[model samples]
Target: MAKYLIKSDATIKAAKPKPAPYRLFDGDGLYLLIRPDGKKWWRLDYTIAGKRKTISIGVYPSTGLSLARDKAKGARALVAANTDPSDARKAAKVKQAEANEAERRVAEGIPLENSFEAVARAWYAKKSSSWVPSHGDKIIRRLERDLFPWLGARPIGEIKPPEILAAVRRIEARGAIETAHRALTNCGQVFRFAVAEGHIESDPTRDLRGALEPVKGGHMAAITEPAKVAELLRAIDAYRGSLIVRCALQLAPLVFVRPGELRKAEWAHIDLDAKEWRFTVTKTDTGHIVPLAPRAVEILREVQALTGRGRYVFPSARTSERPMSDNAILAAMRRMGIAKEEMTGHGFRAMARTILDEVLHFDAHLIEHQLAHAVKDPNGRAYNRTAHLEQRHLMMRLWAGYLETIKAGANVVPLHGRAAA
Candidate 1:
């Protein structure tokens, strides 16, 4: 305890700096400490368990004489209770810092709801770089159309399984059973992302197993029979549309690539001298190499004469600035009297997979690689785009000649199982 002396604001303002550090006591353990540098600090001296300790209350003007006395009175109370006032002050500072951080985050418009749409957009922005442009667009579009309307503003941490199911049931109600499943899968991904990012404690979608209607596992419509394959080839030859569409139809079964990959093929990705078409496949975002058969190269050369100066090999008949519509081949199929149930643009992939594996008797792995399907190596690693290049080149030539023979009405067997050779 000390006698009360310093009190008035005028005395604090008039106090001069000393040659050494000095203190002006108010009462109890409270005092105003002055240094030779002219800075004034309010300090509290206290004892707990008979040990002396000092703590800064604040500064003069910032903490006036009256306020400093009041702080010292509070410190004396804590010390009487066997608690360290310095420790209490530190705790208060920590709480204040936390409050300040939360306020700053709120001011920044950071989502306080941690809503499903908010977290999903963050995840997509982080992940979209790896996806093909159209693939990224499709993902965000799925969220915008399906999930955002219902749960975009709800706090994701509070969302339960039934809420997610209700959202998906809306998709299923429209007979989009497959789309419902896909939407659920996307929701699961977002929920998992939130869990990983610590935005939520758990994913509500984990327990949604068997919640959606079982989707019918149906293959894309394709003509795998040799007679039917020949008839489809004749129909393609007879298709009297744009030359670009005809050439695309002619090359589709030979390359057996996905429709998007074929239509979006850039001229820069093709090198006739190398007899290779190299580009990243949109579906898997992995490199793919299509070995150009002699006939395929011929078609490329003919098309290049027209579209060589542009970006896409098959620049749209409507605009050279863009790739042809994805439905170009499908529309051609329709015009050729091929019903939707009979075939589709994607049917070429199915046809090639069936005929190459069963009829041509090629190695299943090689066929899978040619189809740009994910095929793992002996070490259980996936083969890169150019995997089995020489073998694939040989297979492409043989496949082209096989299609030519079929078109000529030649009855062919599996060449005595000689595909591997």
Candidate 2:
């Protein structure tokens, strides 16, 4: 078919509107529609799927005769190819919109919606609330430090198993084998979340099982022997550091709470008259009652003279507004000639757990409850914080007395019914 029958721009310019809408046919289903209201439009009429359709090419003069014919030719090509021009136009519009959206996301420093970082952040936001604050902090820090720098910008669907393995391998290369494993697990979660959200087909990390080095399991170093325990108690007594940290060191074995719990202890949580310290356990988000032994109360009373007005019982040496530093106890122990393998801040818990059961012969359940562990009932239900408060109170007193005996260089034999005595 011969096209561009409208030879001159002047011919189109001189064509005026008639009393009613009429067409100036330009051949091959292209026409100039002259409206009675003095308006002219370029139109392309086509047939596809045995149905006739019309599409607007442009306005009359602004889209010149040449441009309108070009548009008409493109639409006719689609019809000949068995494709609908209208559908093609709509698809182009959607593609352009997606490009614009991607540009906007990049400009704002936001990840594309299907990018690994984007999905990982969404997953973190949804799940972090259920975790303890410190735990949640660790997870995000792991992603940012280990994974985000490497794999964050990639589309979650396009991330392969090797890319993920390579990212975590950097962490392993730094000797953080455990952290590398954790980073891989976090990536797997984000990938699974993307899959559930329809962004990816499968978790690539699934193919990476057994790819990294296994973490060696070990317990915190602790002084559980009675003689070493006595030596540690005497070393703490002679620690001429800040009075607050000294009291913390003194109370550690008596209460035997986690190092974090001990460092973050608050004055408001203590009831010295009742000989108990009550606070929420950060690890489990459950309430715990520490039956403060008489000796533990004595240490608190001494520290109270200095820090009773502050928020934390063991306030920072440099700033009372915050709790003591996490390293305060460790640093103090290091200064006292205690090796890391000999004892640690967390070792106090293991020390108490072992000695209380083996030497003191306290009931295992009561000791577990005192240790703020998840002690379950006979029916497999978890026991509440105050399950064995009375017995635990007696056990704490006996334990405190036993410590004093050992600290005084006495060969204290562990006797049953010592609590009654």
Candidate 3:
């Protein structure tokens, strides 16, 4: 409330350094406060919203008395003209803070030639929410274990095929040609994602055909023998690693959906009363309906006993809320003495295909539809639930019963049937 203009001697006497709140006038509404803690603070007192407001320009030693006076005079002029100095001060502070924030963000966005780890992290932050957690972890694990030491720090945009080939070739040197290919493919995807984000001009992984050795092709080993299929089922029933995966294993042959589709099942997708499991297959454009067999439904219900209230049906034992990784079934296969070349995650479909067509003679159209393959014919595209629906439901139940019979150590032939296996 004190007004301006105290002489130097009067100011010195006021600022004599004591533990008390006192003010010195500086030729306007501004004043310097000597806080009891021996700190100097400048205050310009005013009013707004029917309330007294004080704006602190700064501390005196840091924001000297002359400058404090100039700030007070400017604020006083605004007040006399019916402007609120407090709101103006707040607005200016906000502008300064916004400027600082913009500077920080711009600096953070400046792309550098980062290591594989850095780019992987940036890509992850941008894309992780869309991906399953296990998928995100696998991406980083592959980069760290396979590519980081060799090429992690190389700028992604500057990465050439030879550098990529060299990194992949390191894994190949350890005699894992498939792993070498997988590493290259994973890196290619990361590069593509980087390109989408304007981190690179083009993908360096586009034409690495000659760089990494091409895979030798023949025929994939499949469980073609009925006796062998029975043996495999028996082995699966006897698995000891995880009970949830065991249920998945038992359900695999019955439903015979893609291993990934089955493994990553969420709780909301099932309709037990309707005998359907609805899920989208991203590999194929259309949403798929898996007609659950009585056995498949039974397994799902049993799985739900432990996980129904949770987010994912086949939730990872490591964590709830997310489905088990796609590898969960394949790993169970390994424990059951099934070789990778003999069978794989997707090989469950192939396994069912061979048995259903060669052995049981179910219609090919039903099998294809059940596999969720794209049917290009416009009429086929507009398929009713009646067309492949009855056949698929029948095929699934028959397959389920056949598995149950084999699992029970009984010699069984798959039959189009009406009851639960």
Name the best candidate (by TM-score).
Answer: 2
For residues 51-167, what per-residue lDDT tens digits would candidate 1 score against the true structure?
889999899888898788888888889888988988888999988986686567569965444678788888899989988688789889889899988888677888999999999
Each model's number of backbone clashes?
0, 0, 4
Estimate, for each residue in 1-421, the C-alpha lDDT of model 2 and write its tens digit: 2233566778777778777777778889998887988778999888898898998888978899889989999999999999999999999999899789889999998887678899999999998887757779999999998898899888788889999999999999999998998999999899888888888788889999999998864436899999999999999999999999999999999999999899999999999999999999877889999998889999999999999999999999899998999899999999999998889999998988888888888778888888888989989999998887899999899889999999999997776753331
Q: For candidate 3, report its TM-score.
A: 0.57
lDDT of 2: 0.89
- On lDDT, the candidate that comes out on top is 2
Q: In angstroms, how far off is 413's CA in candidate 3?
A: 8.7
- Estimate candidate 1's RMSD in Å: 5.8
Error of 3 at 332 (Å): 5.3
Clashing pairs in 3: 5-27, 115-152, 115-153, 116-152
What overall lDDT goes with each candidate model? 0.87, 0.89, 0.74
How much is the lDDT of residue 267 in candidate 1?
A: 87
What lDDT score is found at residue 346 in candidate 3? 69
